[model samples]
Target chain A: MIDRTGLMVILSSPSGAGKSTLARRLMEWDAGLRFSVSATTRAPRPGEVDGVDYHFTSRAGFEQMVADGQMLEHAEVFGNLYGSPRGPVEQAMLAGRDTLFDVDWQGGQQIRASALGRHVVSIFVLPPSLPELERRLRGRGQDSDAVIAGRMEKSRSEISHWAEYDYVLVNDDLDETEARMRAILTAERLRRDRQSGLGGFVRALMAEEA
Target chain B: MIDRTGLMVILSSPSGAGKSTLARRLMEWDAGLRFSVSATTRAPRPGEVDGVDYHFTSRAGFEQMVADGQMLEHAEVFGNLYGSPRGPVEQAMLAGRDTLFDVDWQGGQQIRASALGRHVVSIFVLPPSLPELERRLRGRGQDSDAVIAGRMEKSRSEISHWAEYDYVLVNDDLDETEARMRAILTAERLRRDRQSGLGGFVRALMAEEA
Candidate 1:
């Protein structure tokens, strides 16, 4: 197998745009893919395992990690500080394993501007239509009208950043969007800069006698 | 179907590296793909169709086209001028059809630096090994030992520029290489800049009422 450095693949979308389903399918498609688990200051719910669900930490601890530059990208969400830890991502990169991030546009921007930006492949997913998105949000049936309205506003704000991504897909059909994501992953893995062993491989080929 | 601007896909490699076979397979896979037939000052050989094989032109005519900015890129080889015509490629782009160019490293570099550089997706193919390359070169059994030696030297010169490509594949197996190329094409088609209709699509999405 060709040895390659890991890619930081960031998938961003509004709440009802099928990004979660696509991300889950991608992980199932490639067992080698590592899902980046964020470090959060919030308390874990029942059955949530540390390091698996998230790296649950105290607010002070989270702030220390951020100040020490251990966070690749961090943001404040609903009074909690959440961030992607750099240590696990760096380890994965050294081991030639790609890490996938499910983030909003703000986190995507932050990661793309980070020091490891060159390895990033950012994709934005769009809902088929605003009406479709509202339908899906309403389909959840757990939220009242006011909560759904607030979510719709948040979704609109997230959708405004579609042009900032490298690739954008309208998730009109889940299977097709999944296939496109697979294609993007496969192609990005073969990029010249990502293949770490190519230099040595080329040297060996050139040394062979005709 | 997603409407997209045309991609100028350039495939370059040393001779006997299976580039021709891969190009052929790609054409067969996508019927909409346009193979760039070059314009040349060389006289047409027996049974060679002028337009289909090459846009056979007089030396003066070729020079005039270059001076008029009609050639996307040009090169002189073996006392003949060869170039990719810009007119057809532009028309293809306007019609949302992709054009594939089978060129050497020099041609690839020129086209990439041209005005349409942003739309270009360049790939370099490498033979598995020098010995394997020599074996394939000899399999044809149509050249003298001196000619084969000269070809090997030329191949080495071509292989030196593999690092300049956006993507490079060591052609150990034809089927796997072809699959990778397809993935690259598919992913490139989804690039935000290539999809011309996306801006309006996003506008319509935002205009939808909650």
Candidate 2:
């Protein structure tokens, strides 16, 4: 029986749908989950560490890795290149680890194309309502009216692709949303098709009959 | 804001995958869920009430309902006609209730064909191992070896159609499995696309901006 297999979970949402919050809560709840740290060309923010927050890489290094197909999926967002590295995620999976990806619908599609196994599950998070989303964005107190308006417009486009996800969650309440997210991770981990040792486990039981 | 919208959920599994157990637990846990009581031609067992356990009907009555397309779907199993009625389920939906169907793959397929909406979610349950399934079947002690063998064969056929489900749960442990099932139900209820008031909710917020 194969003992180790990896799961890649891609979580997509509009800016205020609580994707990041859910991811953080899941990591805290599940010790087996590891975040898929992307290699990015953007400069790290204060207190962000390379290989922790992100794998800070130069443009040439990023392009070389992309050319070598070391990255599972890569994209140019906001003029900066960001990509998921294949080697690390594969290593984690082989060690029976789950990886979480905080990405958009496009990135989720790329991962699905590259990894077509039972190990991948994609989820989309949505706000309870467009009005509530606007309220949440305004409550953040970080963006101007124009910035919030721009984000709202982008949210509509992002939400239009809701049907693309394996599971869709409406973030109406924080605690309840976190609980639902945890349940998906737990269920996905127990999928028989992804559990490598299942065939052997069955064989062992059937041996008694023989 | 639309206050009443109904969702139809189908839970199917190979025998010993705990579909009935999970469905029972979900009904006890969630008040919003209403089990779809199917109409059947078979006479009710001792103490079984019509309309509660089932809507007992004569063969002629069943045939008439089918001819009128009043049944959402119907099938014959063990010389008994069984079908889900369309009117009551739609009424529940209009009154803001979610209906659960403990059905086989065929019934699920028919529901998908008839009700492919944001409110519909289907899940397939799987046993963690074939050996476990065999053990569970044998442990029941009611089936002969021949009957057990027949069930095992049928299970393999059922499992082959796992890909047809939107979500798959491996029933390894009862509590975990029940929790996962509940999570799916809860999450589906909150999906923005399924929730009716979202459009008006958004409009209200946009109006405030003016």
Candidate 3:
């Protein structure tokens, strides 16, 4: 029998590097993968589902999870608490489901710290260049000039952490980028160290031979 | 335009891990990849082509290439000198052609020591178990009992170096094994550090928007 070990893929990138776009595309391609819905204190938008989009909780509830070690990683972002719940992710992984996280560098670090022994593979998406990153930000047209400037400034700091990732992909072309990200996840899933059932599978093959 | 960077993939496995089978399948699936023919001191076998099958070189010539830093990595195996030449590999990579190397753990180490940086991704394949490995060797019907025993013994040492590889695959099922190997190659190709042309491409998109 094949070993069905779970994989955790954390995708991080600057705002316009298309991390979210790639993440959505990956979910479409791989049915075994499920998005890790974050728990946040912020109120959900009109169209967002409470459990599906995010686990919306109040400050008290969020604090309780943190205290009980139910939150894998929690952070106060923009004065609202945002976190990943340990319960659902652990449950999914135990049942052999790969989880995908669209998180920032800070969140990635937090996840790493909390889930040290878990099969986690982190990838950093980079824009091809500083000029390209700035261009992507400007092209979005939704942000004001000041906001774009702030993002570009933050991008430098974020990109500096590229080396921290297990894999780094530059989002030059969406199709190619998506293909590459999918490949990384696929390769990592087959890693022997991550596949706990491999030993038993080998023993079974040996038994048949004997 | 996509910067077509060539990738060199080195796959090493103990006998019966199905390295050759996997290599053949990969070649059939991807047209862009070509096998790296080694320069050997030994004479060519029946149907081998001089330049195509191997760069069949004399011992002196092979040694010369080694001394001149022309060979990427070389070793004396079973009374014959075998080495991967640097020139053809570099040319192929520059021309956007991927190369595959069927080498052992020693060769893998040599390539890593050279630090080609981003151009090389190495994978090691393992059979599910020692008994399975022995069974596969015996089932091949190509070796004597003594030879099979030697291979099984050697495999223990070979597998001990599994930590050196970027990825490891257990060959339990042929189809899944092939798919997993291909996935690693594809993913490594998309790595941001390796794809220098990505910066230019993304910049061009930004320029267009501007």
Candidate 4:
């Protein structure tokens, strides 16, 4: 196999577009792929593991990490600070393990503009149709009409940034989208710049007399 | 399904590295893929068909085409003029069909610097090792020792340009290399810039009231 450096795969989409499902499928497909855990100031929900789900941190700790440039990307939502700690991601990349980031457009953009942007391969997922997206949202049977409407509004705004991604996939079928994501990962790993051992291999080949 | 523009896939390798075999396999795998036939001033050998195996032309005709900017890339090899005709390639791309180029490093560089260079995805193929490449070259049984030695020299020169390509594959296993090429093609097709109908598709999705 080819020896390569790790890649940063950013999967961004609105809720109900199957972005999370696709990300999960990718992680299941490649055992070496690592999920980037976000640091959050919000209290953990019942039964949710602290580091497994999110790195639950105090607001002061999160703000300090952000101010110290330890956060790759940070955003304040509903008065709670959420940010991706840069330490683990960098460590994973240096160890040649690809890290997956499930984030919104703002976070995707911020990560792509970060210092390690060149390693990022950003993808945006879109629903097959707006009605299908709304139907999926309603199928949850938990959100009220007002909540669904607000979510739909947010989804529309997020979809507007689809063109900013390096690759865009319409999640018409979960299986097909998952396959496409795998193909993207495979191809990006083969990129010339990512093949770290290729130069030495080629040098040895040249040294050998035919 | 996604509606996308075409791509130019350049496959380059030293002779005896299985580039031609891989290109043929790719064509067999994708019926829609087109192979670029080069125009040459050399006389056709037995069973060689013009416009298929090669576009046989006079030296004056080849120079005229080159001067008129009809040739995408051309070089003089073994006292014969050889060039890739731009017309068919452009037409294939306009029709949304991918075109494959079987050329060496110089030709690859020229095509990469051409006007349609943005559409090119160049790949370099390397043999598993230098001794393997020599073994394959000698296995042909069509050349004497001196001819094989000269070819080995040329192969080394060609392999030196491997870094110039977008992707490099060590052809240790043909099936695996072909699969990697397919993955690269699949992922590249989903690139945001290549999806020509994406803008209209996104507009319709936004227009639909959720």
Candidate 5:
């Protein structure tokens, strides 16, 4: 019921962690929340929509957007370019609609250091244990042993940065993690500095008996 | 579920502003939460239970507790002394249980400045409007005009201190306010510094494949 500025919820976790699943659950729980869609240089394989799954653009277009400061953050991953568009984020905040980001620690840090960084609430999610994380990764039944090992090494590097986050959660159980994330969103929305309507609300309260 | 250090959730509001009701609801919402019961010099009237409604004590005993630093904070109201005992609060935090405080701004400031200040999260509740506040006070059908006027003045003083709190919520809707409070607690619990167990959790993860 509060009229407030939207928050940028940055969720970072290593591959095989449940950050993506948790993010999906949170968005489903609150349909009003928007997921940040990154612009990618990779060609769509099949069912990926242009603006929904990603903003597919030519390499030249992606480079130009980055040069023009349109991208909040951009990077070259395995020869493909990908980055979040800054326009939608800024517009969402102005409209009091929160946007969620599923990014690694590098992207999380970049957005938090941006001009709109004050709006960011970064959370790091960890698996219950390394064995559990590997079990889940193997459960996918697609990645070979070599791929799983490389992913596990990458997870160690990512997990080392957990201390950098404002809040950290161990995703032992998906439902519990989802509940905590919802609570965090609920609390962040009520922060006094985020509620733009508070000044008028207080003014009216004072004028009531005047 | 998270295992972490307990926090001091201080809720302060003006007379007729609905803080007490909110505090009651919050305690009921989480049975594990401990209420910081105040020690009073006044006699227990009606159904008031000692050690629950209050810690009944003689004026001398209460004064001695304050002098000995046993009282977290104390105040003299209408020739009677009332204060929160520090022992139980300290014990509660060490046991990893949250403690809730229903205090005025003075008590809030005191608790926040105490040695355990880092553990406190103060929230101030604001009335929707003075007219609505006055209407509620009148609807209670107990107080006289002179009493109501005095309360309104006291409320203004209370409202003036809203800026001192970590959070300021307008109590226009009860359920919304409660939900927000729960969210704050959840997020605070996940603060990396609060969860002392996280270090061991992460260590276990690292040792999984080693």
Candidate 6:
């Protein structure tokens, strides 16, 4: 295998499309794959782990990181600050290990616009149908009726940005969507431009028996 | 699976890089995938079937087709004329079945420059090393020393065009390379812009419970 430069995999989706579930499964499938543990000012829920689930931070701390150019992308949701750190993602890329981003379209666009944008492979996940999406959100039972309504509106807005993504997968089934993500990674890794060592490798090939 | 628009797969490689082997494996994997049948002025070797292996034609006949603007791409090799017909490729695309082109860099460039170019996914296959490539070619033992020398020179010339491809895969092993090609096809089909019905689907998604 060629020592390929790692990619930044940005998985964007509207709420209830199971983006988190798919991202988690991908991490499990490849242990070396790193997750962009987002920094958030929101308090951790019952089972959440700091630095694992998210890097819990004070609002000021998050703002400081953003000001210092440490955050790859940042945004506020329900008065809580959340952002992806640039350090770990950069480290992962240099180490030839991919970093997975579970972000919305706004965050996805920001990362794609960043200096390291060329390293990114952006995929948008669409729920099978709007009714099914609403059903999945309701099945989670974590949000109230008003919250669901808000989420539905946000989803519509998010879907508008689907055209911006490099790949768009309709999440009709969990395993299939996960499989598609795996395929994208497998293929993207082989792109000529992504393999930095190709120049040296090709030169070595030419030298033999020439 | 999404009903994806068919793509034009162009696989180019230096001699002995196993391009033909991988292309054959892909055809076997998906019987629906069409192998582009090129029209050639060369006479059929004993068992070569008309319209199957190649559309064997007289030089004048091939020239007429070229003059009529029937060929998507045409080239002269050694002393024979060979060209890919446009009609079947367009028809296959409309039927939602990908057509594979095992062409050299020149042919690949022509097809990419054609009107159907946007649907093309071009891949270049490289041998693991020059020594290995020579070993594979010699193992075939089907060419004279002078012919082999000419092929080696041609291979080097072909390798120069590797940068023109969308993806470059090192053909170190057969099965692994075939698997990579399959993955590329799977991912390329999911590119958002390739699925034309996506707009209607997303609009329908918004219509639900809004």
Q: How much does each candidate deviate at the interface, measured as C-alpha RMSD after superposition? A: 1.0, 5.1, 4.9, 0.8, 1.6, 1.5
- Count of clashing pairs, candidate 3: 1
Q: Count the backbone clashes (under 3 Å) in each candidate.
A: 0, 1, 1, 0, 0, 0
Chain A: TM-score in each model: 0.97, 0.94, 0.95, 0.98, 0.97, 0.95
| Residue-wise C-alpha lDDT for candidate 4, range B131-177, written one tens digit per residue | 99999999999999999999999999999999999998899999999
Tens-digit lDDT track of model 5 for A103-184:
9888988898999999999899998788888888999999999999999999999998988888999887889889999988
Q: Candidate 6: what lDDT?
A: 0.91
On TM-score, the leading prediction is 4
Q: Give the per-residue lDDT digits (tens) of candidate 2, residues A1-210.
A: 236487899999999878888999899998889999999999999999999999999999999999998988889989999999989888898898889999888888888888543577888887877777888889899999999999998888887777777777667888977887777776566555676675565455334441
List the candidate numbers ranked by TM-score, top first: 4, 1, 6, 5, 3, 2
* C-alpha positional error of residue A29 in candidate 6 after TM-score superposition, expressed in Å: 1.6
- Poorly placed runs, candidate 6 (over 4 Å): B1-3
Q: After superposition, which runs of candidate 1 have C-alpha atoms over 4 Å from their true positions? A: none
Clashing pairs in 5: none
Q: What is the C-alpha lDDT of each candidate?
A: 0.93, 0.80, 0.81, 0.93, 0.88, 0.91
Candidate 5: tens digits of C-alpha lDDT, residues B28-107: 99997999999999999999998889999998898889889998888888989889999999899988999999999999
DockQ of every model listed?
Answer: 0.83, 0.20, 0.33, 0.86, 0.69, 0.75
lDDT string, candidate 6, B120-158, tens digits = 999999998887887788899898888888888999999
The docking quality of candidate 6, as DockQ, is 0.75
| lDDT accuracy of residue A169 in candidate 4 | 91
User: For residues B71-107, what per-residue lDDT tens digits would candidate 3 score against the true structure?
Assistant: 8889987999999999888898998788999988888
Write the number of the candidate with greater DockQ, choosing between 1 and 4: 4
RMSD for all candidates, in order, please. Answer: 1.4, 4.8, 4.6, 1.2, 1.8, 1.5
By the DockQ metric, which is better: model 3 or model 6?
6
lDDT of 6 by residue, A1-210 (tens): 667778999999998898989998999999989999999999999999999989999998999999999999999998999999999898889989999999999899899999999999999999988889888999988999999988988998999999999999999989989998899998899888998888888888788884
